[model samples]
Target: MKWLWRSIASLALGLGALGVVLPGLPTTPFLLLAAWAGARGWPQMEQRLLRHPKYGPVIIDWRERRAVPRKAKWMASALMLSSLVSIWLLPAPMLLRWFLTLFLPCVALWLWSRPNS
Candidate 1:
């Protein structure tokens, strides 16, 4: 199953890379998955991710402390807010807007509660 894990790792890494540049595409979760799969299938790949300039510290912080960096927390919250605002301003149904209005805050709360690493 090592080959299967390696394939999953490769796919997750690719998606994580795309997430880094694509708005609304989350990076950390995918990177986290990649790291897990990489550890099982390709040790070098996992090490390289752990050594990545941008995402390495984040992965390590999460693994070691289950924490989020303050900067990351702020950025994520801001992005969520912006997305909410965009949704509000769009021509979507009122119910959809209401759902997002309620949902985004709950997401923000969870994000804010994480210890800063």
Candidate 2:
């Protein structure tokens, strides 16, 4: 059971890392989950996550101060805007478009509102 959790956490973090390259996929939230899961399932993985260059500081900031860097805030905001624009332009269902538009911007806002560290 513990190993299962560790695998799941590692998978989530790996997917999150992949999200870094794939647009519209989230990074921080998944990393947060990975950190949470690592705490319970794999201390070593957690430590590795903390030591990661791209994600480590963000995780640490979130853990210590619930903060994100200012650059991250701007990047998140821009990505959300781009996503919203793509949703509008895409020939998707109205419900799907509305849902993403409403939900993603709110997420961006919440993330942006956090204090930058």
Candidate with top TM-score is 2
Q: What local lDDT score does residue 72 receive in model 1, on the 0 to 100 scale?
A: 74
User: What are the runs in model 2 whose C-alpha is more than 4 Å off?
Assistant: none
Report the C-alpha lDDT of model 1 over 1-117, residue by residue, as the tens digit: 999999999999999899989987878889999999999999999999999998899999999988998877888888999989999887889999999899999989998898998
Instruction: Determine which window of 10 residues in candidate 1 has minimal summed lDDT.
Output: 69-78
Residue 112, model 2, lDDT: 77
TM-scores of the candidates are: 0.82, 0.83
Decoy 2 TM-score against native: 0.83
**Residue 67 in model 2: lDDT:** 97
